[model samples]
Target chain A: MKVDIVVDARYKSCPGPLLALAEAVMKASPGQIIMLLATDPGAPRDIREWALNVGHKVLNIEKADETYQIYLEVSS
Target chain B: MSKISIIVASEKLDKLLPAATLATTAAVMGWESEMFFTFWGLLALKRDYEPKEVSSDYKVYEDYLRRAVSSGAMPSWLEILEQGKKTGRLKVYACSATMSFLGVKTEDLVEYVDGVVGAASFLSKAKDSDINLFIS
Candidate 1:
């Protein structure tokens, strides 16, 4: 719930949102929380899959006004 | 780590977009990703060359694709490839035969190209890949 970084990738399509999050994750300390805001329809699933592959934790996903708010926790 | 090997055979924007997307995605996912640009695909590696056109049948939607990139909805194919490269997990190879056929020298290629390789060399490197894709 304590978000340390916010990555705004709304209106960016596939790879954009994920790439932004990946970049943030690289700079994040272990246990830091990053919230990604993305408008692309595929962002949620893409983020989930990417987190799984990269060993991050997806805290939660919420949808509002056609945008997705994805919460992630950085891993060591 | 899993590995994905892609053989790119076209210079068209549409073909290159998907190929780049897949290769980059695989790299970011901690997989070993390699792309061999052969035939027309090799043109995309040429210095200062940008593939603006789609395949003939998709000409009508070329503008649509361009707009998406311009409007910031989609990243350019090269941008995607560059992101993957930043992770140090992706390898890009230009086809040696195509270079000779197209009269492209090593200096003609963009700096990101890892090397120029022949079919046998690429195949031997790609043989253990978990996934293989031919994108044209």
Candidate 2:
């Protein structure tokens, strides 16, 4: 099953929420898809680097107005 | 898959903020994160003693509290936990042994705590975690 979470990170700049989302997705066993919704302008670049470092797949990223949607697939 | 478990052991307000910040960061990275507060750290979960304007760096305890309140940060320990909870990725657990030693009940803890758990329980849950952090 796919786990989808929407994070409203507009008020905070720290990478905490994005890190948490990635961890949650990884714990969902292998081959699970995690969809993260974030409004933070820095999320895309930060999350991209984080995913690469952790060996997760950054499937796609889509921008919708002021928010961004990131889809990540757990590869390990 | 990444999972992290954090153990908080200090009651000092300043120390707790850094730990909470790290926990929030772990959660944001898509990790299943759990924080176990024990010993002095339990004091930080109390409902009273909100720090309003705390200085990020303090040479003394009083200065820390004064700056915390002046900065309009957290004036009470409970408020700090509330701010962490609002991030929505953290699970806060109070140590059961500490509560018993202090003769405190679970209801006496701040509302943000998930439950009162023991060290064994916490360790078991953390066995599979990719990262384990201890904040003292």
Candidate 3:
């Protein structure tokens, strides 16, 4: 299965949405591809590193203007 | 596993505790977590502040933050979040603009932060995240 998750991190308050997404992905079945969208500059490297540390693959990273597109493949 | 971004913008201990708790909880559940401390939230990562007593309703928050720290107790707000970075797959970033506004040198921040960056950089990086949060 494939899912596209958009995390609007542009606000200066609230971290619940991001945490929810991570929990959802962790509970998802294997072989799922999740595309995450974030606006925080730290999202790319931070997410990439987290995926790597927890046995997920960061498939692609693309940037357009002020947005980021991160693709992940669940391996576990 | 996927990407999660938690953005903190408030400097108040009360307001910041929720975001920290959520991030640490996600990490404990085996999910990869990243907390981006921006604006006033970056102040909580400063090395000099001590943990203050919160209201009774906030005891859970205090407890959670305490547990997330290294000494099995909250050393301070700064220490609590720092421990989250160490014990879990958590990465913390200080907002570049905020740092400059607050006259926060890189050396002034606690050791848990991964780097200092502007909003543009943070937005570009977080664009592909699975989850994004903004905590006040």
Best by lDDT: 1
Which tens-of-lDDT digit does each residue in A1-76 have in candidate 1?
Answer: 7889999999998889998899899899999999999999998999899899999999999999988999999999
iRMS of each prediction = 0.8, 6.1, 9.1
When sorted by TM-score, best at the front, the candidate numbers are: 1, 2, 3
TM-score for all predictions?
0.98, 0.58, 0.52
Q: Write the per-residue lDDT of candidate 3 for residues B1-136, one digit (tens) a residue.
A: 6667888877666666667766665564456777778876887778876545444566767655545443422233443355456555777889988888889899988777788887888887778878899877
Residue A13 C-alpha lDDT in model 2:
40
1 or 3: which has the higher lDDT?
1
In terms of TM-score, how similar is model 1 to the real structure?
Answer: 0.98
Query: Compared with the true structure, what per-residue lDDT tens digits does model 3 show for residues A1-76?
Result: 3565444433212233234346557566677777776665766776766676567888887888877777777786
| lDDT (C-alpha, whole model) for all candidates | 0.94, 0.68, 0.66
| Alpha carbon deviation, residue A26, candidate 1 (Å) | 1.1
| Candidate 2: tens digits of C-alpha lDDT, residues A1-76 | 3555444444334343464465476467677777777766777888887777567888888888876777888776
Residue A56, model 2: Cα distance from true site in angstroms: 14
Q: Show how many residue pairs clash in every candidate, following the order shown.
A: 0, 41, 24
Worst window of 10 by summed lDDT in candidate 1 chain B: B66-75
Name the Cα RMSD for model 2: 7.7
Q: Chain B in candidate 1 has what TM-score?
A: 0.98
